[model samples]
Target: MRQLPKLSFWQIWNISFGFLGVQFGFALQNANASRILSNLGADLHHLPLFWLAAPIMGLIVQPIVGHVSDRTWNRLGRRLPYILGGALVSMLAMFMMPNASMVVAWMAPVLFGAIIFALMDGSFNVTFQPFRALVADMLPDEQRNVGYSIQSFLINAGAVIGSILPYVLTNMMGVSNEAPDGQVPQSVIWSFYIGGAILIISVLVTVFKTKEYPPAEFNEYKNISEAEQQEKQSFWVTLRSMPKTMVQLAVVQFFAWFALYLMWVYTTPAVAQHFWHTPVGDAGSAQYNEAGNWVGIIFGAYSLFAALFSIAMPWLAKQWGRKTVYALALLAGCLGFVSMYFLTNPNHLIVSMIGIGIAWAAILSMPFAILSSALPAKKMGIYMGIFNFTIAGPQIISGLLGGTILKTFFDGQAIYILIVAGVSMLLGAIAVYFVDDIHAKSH
Candidate 1:
């Protein structure tokens, strides 16, 4: 079998640059979606259900995009076509999401926001799944760690900007942070608009600057026998034949994503209530909007730390082993979540983000690095798509439970939700210990 050629640093950068755009759009959604939903008149109890659009659409879109991208070969290359198409759709969705209330006065604002959220998420999955596969495809085993780390770095880099955009706009550029009831802030609206433009432009750079190996070259490099090449693996067949490592890693992914889902869904309300003393129904209050923008800055802190930590994760993985590093990182994240309950000063939450950022960097790079080694080269895209199930499934389950948990158990206290997230992350840390790191084993 001929090994894949090692790509130069710039080549790797070019291929992974699109992640900046993808994450730029995604981070905006993550940091702002809850605020938007609340602004559109969503109640605190039902917020999780409304935020369901992202993970639900991801559940449906990622695997299909992966399967199709695996078989596709066009002038735009296998993954690039999907990347470009998804970027355009995502750009439109980002632009429209913040404006959902404005477009249809008669439509329920929550419903409109949900539809737009799904569109943004589905488009993101289309680009995201293939991009993961592309890294595995283009890089040899020795370099896959670095490739994934670079992707993580760019992902968090974009996230930093995306997360901070609204805060920066309002604070520095003097954009209005407050709007009338049922409308999102002008700062957030402009942030989305700028984010959309950057998303498309960054993706186009990757589409033009990076080239994919043709099918014949790819088959030859992986040493696929003609018969094996010709045999099409049904989705069920692939599902049944998944590597044991992938199955084990899925367990780790589940709790990790579940914890993250809670944070994303409740952070805005939690911060508003905890720091700003805004009541549950005060979405239109100036204090509430200010709290939301502060959440953006807090998220930016984590993203910035994640980007910096990504630079060190690969080396740490090499020294301590992937599973060890991952588990420890998750443990830190668990503590980070727990720290939230004690934080009286909102800005002090940046300390909590340091631990969370370490985990974020590890989460973005480690599983993919390990899983890529165990996957069949020909089936990389599909398996990566299926791997997303672990991510989306946990999120879906968490969203379903979030409202019930808030109403029944917490007395509508969002701070308690952070404690639950901390415990969930602790479970994830334990789960990671069970994953067999094929890369570490092989080395």
Candidate 2:
């Protein structure tokens, strides 16, 4: 195999920068969607149902985007076209989401909000899966960890900004965190707007600055056989031929994403009820809004710690094996999530966030790094797209059963859902031990 040249740190950073925008948008969605929906009249039990929009979008969108982008080469380059297109759509979605009430006067704001949520996440999925393939396409095997680590850093950095923006606007700039009946607060409205603008600008930097190898050069560098390069197989057919590592990774992904789904769909309610002493289904209350803002700060802490951890993770992985580091990071997150069940002080949550942040870093980078070495050169994009099922699948299952489980087992307490999340993450940590990393020791 012709070795791909090592990229400078800045070169890798620039290539991964577009993800900063995607994760920024994602952070906004994760931190605020429950709040926004509740403000618009949805029950807490239905929040997970609403969140099904994102993963469903990812499940359908990523593989198609991936399959098409694998064959898509143009002036903008293979992944750039999708990256740019998705960003533009995402910008529009961000603008539309918080303003879902105003758009369709005849429809319920909650329903419109769900639709917009789908669009926002669908657009993110468009950019996200390709970004994964892009790293595998560009970086040599030895540099793959760096590429993904840098990508993880950018992702968490963007998340930190996005998650905190509403709180910043409310507290620092004196924007109103309250709104009229059935309307989202001004701080949230403004965060989406700013996030949209930054999304497009950051994506433009990547589209304009980074270049992709043309098809001919990429094939030569990866040493793909001509017949394999030209070969077309149905996704299901290719699924049967999947690498053992990908299958193993999927098992771990299921639990990791299941845990994350609980956090995203329930954290606002859990924190509001537990720390802020808000009533169930309390929307548009001062206490609830305060809880929402604090959740933003807390989620920002999660991403900030994730960003900080990303810098240290590669070194840790190199010292221990990647799988070992991944397991330990998830263990930290399990402790963090389980602790949330017992903590009532808002500020003390930051201590718990540190562990989740470390796990988030490993979750973002380690699996992809492990999988990249096992994937076929000719099908990086499609396989990366398919790997997303591991992400979206568990979340889908969680969303479907989440409400029922909560009511049945936990007396509908959101805090107890976090305990379930902890258990799931613990399972993921254990599953990490079984993954067959092709470069298990080296990375």
Q: Which model scores highest in lDDT?
A: 2
Please, what are the lDDT tens digits per residue for candidate 1 over residues 97-154? 9998876657887788888998999999999998899999899998988999999999
Q: By summed lDDT, which 10 consecutive residues of candidate 2 come out lowest? A: 275-284
The TM-score obtained by model 1 is 0.98
Candidate 1 lDDT for residue 117: 93
Task: Provide the clash count, candidate 1.
Answer: 0
- In order, the Cα lDDT scores of the candidates are 0.91, 0.92
Considering only N, C-alpha and C atoms within 3 Å, which residue pairs clash in candidate 1? none
lDDT of 2: 0.92
Residue-level lDDT of model 2, residues 23-131, one tens digit each, is 9999999999999999888988888899999899999999999899989889989998999999999999999999888965699888999989999999999989888
Q: What are the runs in model 1 whose C-alpha is more than 4 Å off?
A: 441-443
